[model samples]
Target: MQTPVHGSLLKPLQVNEAVGVWFHFSHSGSTALPHLPADILKWSKNYQNITYGVLDTPFQTVTTYANNSCLLLLDGRIDNLATLNDAYQISDPSVQSVVWYLYVTFGIKGFYRLKGRFTLVLYSVESEKTMLYRPYLSGFPLYYQSQEGGYTLSTNPLQLCDTKNSVTPLDKQRVAHYFTADPLKFSSHPFHSLSKLEPGEIVLMDAEGVEKIRQPVHEAFPKQAIPTQKDAIYRAYRRLIETAVSETLREDIDYGIMLSSGIDSATLAYHASKLLSKRGKKLIAYSWKLPNDAADESEKVKALCETLEIELKLLSAEGMGPFDEVGSMAYNPGSPVTNAFARLNRECYKLASRDGIKYLLNGNFGDMLFKYGQPKLTELWKERQFGQLLLALKRVSKKVIPAETQVRTPWLTDEVKSLRKEKTHSETGKTDYRYALCDFHEDYFGGERYLSGVYGITRLEPHRNSALVNFCLQLPQTLHS
Candidate 1:
């Protein structure tokens, strides 16, 4: 089915159209023949009460399945297609096809069996029930708008508009929380009228309105016995890293990876090079060349690439003006740009697009998943652990990185202070390290994911594997070293 290209369509789609929306409009007798945004209406078809529109995005893997009565649209890649196809007795299953097979084979419980980053919409004419689902740690996004007569859903928020197709104002409260306070405070869409689907969530919408069906967190991160031996833990961790990287590599695409001197990116680059080499493919690595004012890690990045024998591409962040693109990007995801770092990130993607690179893997969030949490020294002090408190303070004070850019936001600063007043007793003065890491992870990854979509690049994070995150979280804080 043809789809509408909405406002703020990414320029990368002009060449490689990949991302798309599978919008389902269910109409009733009193609904007066529901309408979608003009873009959808232009290319959509109505079969019975449902109208489906698929928006084209760059480097998106979309699969569709229809057996007369049931229809499904899947947007995103399936890492385990071969395994799933064999288990389901199907040939070359797409992500959505696997979902359909499982749903048919094991009922709704089948969704839990699939892995990879994907968003799906399923409609069953027999049950007259339409379901929307997103996997845990989904790299894609989905938005929905529920109204009195009918509801609308799409992968692009721009498609979920009023009858006149006018856009709503920015959600200032949520914007403030994300910018100054807690980025995880609200996972909902930045638009006031629409809601964003959270990871590990499934929602069913019918004539009765929207009802959420929470899916069980996949055993990707099960509570396994932590290996006490450092060697055993390191070996297991290395295996996890290898497996996650191997699974995410797409044979059809020549993917590049983000490389820095940092352990996270460097580690992934090392493993990725080995795996890709086995198949006789040379991995290409990209590193940001920031202005001289910024810390230059080019020497370190070059050393790793040379050692690994991977082709290195350095994208310059010198001439990229930070303030100019802020307005446009703010509307892309309906969220404010956090800092100057976001500018560098966008520039990197733009450079990738110019060089014809569609997939870029990064090792972000590696610290959060590992035993990177610091002990709450203040909490220890309250219990009269004077020795531990001093040690904790020394550890925390050892390293401090200054902010890249500072903008004066008096109102935002005051409002955030007010919001923090409602913190729990444990969070009033001092907070646990895990809590801080969780907040940072949510904010950092959440914004990055959305922005990458805007730049028309599929950003992969093998390090964000659920099993890896769970294992790290289970480790003792003392093991953080």
Candidate 2:
């Protein structure tokens, strides 16, 4: 195994206890680095690459291997270890060992089959190439910034900026998107210099510069005929859920779920409880009770947790407004906040972290799987499908539009007209799938990163798995209804 690089620079930057990593790649010998957080596992440098890494919450132990020809850094769980070990004809296996073996055996093709939330940085002397990648449905954040000869890569954007010689700037477009109700769904970074490595994307760097080696990570909606039978679709979904949840439950650590009254969280809690119970463990569920009437969803949460025999921890966050402690909360530099409940969310995570819970299974993006909020009515009207349009509007009036929103119908109409007068990226798509994509980027990727950073916890949203998402997308829209 490779050892951590020794020696300090002219001025080293300070690193937080939270999980983070930062590195600058240069062909000119070395790049100045920021002081690393206390949680980092390794900070190594060679002629071609300099890397900084921190142990991820659940995956705290990491083994680095380096020689004159290849350098490997891995910080997360690898689920298919046995298969990889068998394929490479090895007895002992670890994420680092598997990654090195796979690369030596299959080159870049080795990453495609990788399963888990991980950030990997590999440098090859023979090929003179540096590659960075994460899972298809990213479990963690990975970002990069191009430089003169090479580039800088980091798990934490703030750390990159904090480097002693760093000059990264805030990205205006990304900031604007974060403040808006509807943000663009595409991959973007909060900083002008850094870029988010989209799900399943892999980028290779050399002496010349950095370049995306393949198309964006993850598959798009399929164009083929989808499974038509509801029973078959349901069965497939069940299997996917079971597999996803099972793969995430680490036997050595205690895990919890973010339970709410919503179907998504309830479903996850039920299944997780059932699976863990079989292993002689009781699943702990966390629920936040806000002072606002709208935030009260305890009735269903209580019943579901009780039925599953799960340990429910009800947090009374009464009088804790969404905007409370906004300025004082753990601040991730350059991160944006659109929701007022960020404070409450942070409190829940802090509690979990304090209790030594490293993982929290969330049901984010679950509604998208069922086509919950399609702009179908708006599209129907735009298409001039008068008959369908009328039916859609009527259905919307009955089931979609809330009474509170109806009361401000005239105001809403005026606001819509005003919005049309302005150039907005949110107005790009008119389909449910498009909206889902946007929401996934905004709500899941952007928001979760800040939350995860503040509390030192990893949020696992298995519903956002690429396989599950592709399957749902392939099914007919009729099934969604």
Candidate 2 residue runs with Cα over 4 Å from true position: 1-18, 27-59, 88-107, 147-149, 163-190, 215-227, 252-254, 292-296, 306-311, 316-338, 353-358, 364-368, 371-438, 441-458, 464-466, 477-481
Candidate 1: regions farther than 4 A off: 1-18, 22-56, 79-101, 104-107, 162-190, 218-220, 252-254, 277-280, 289-303, 306-311, 315-338, 364-368, 371-458, 476-481
TM-score, prediction 1? 0.64
Instruction: Report the lDDT tens digits of candidate 1 across residue range 1-481.
Output: 3443222211111213533464545546232123323322333333123333323334554555554445566676556778888876875365445666788788765776777777777776556677777766654567777654466776655445531322222332222223222222443433457666655556776665666655432233445676765556556666777888887785755677766555456667778888878887767777766556445567767777777788888877676444323321222233454444455555566677677777888642223342222333122112343344335423432322112312111112232334322212321233222121242233433444444545566677776576765665454332333
Error of 1 at 140 (Å): 1.8
Instruction: Please report the candidate that would top TM-score against the real structure.
Output: 2
Assess candidate 1 and give its lDDT: 0.52
Would you list the C-alpha lDDT of every candidate in the order shown? Answer: 0.52, 0.52
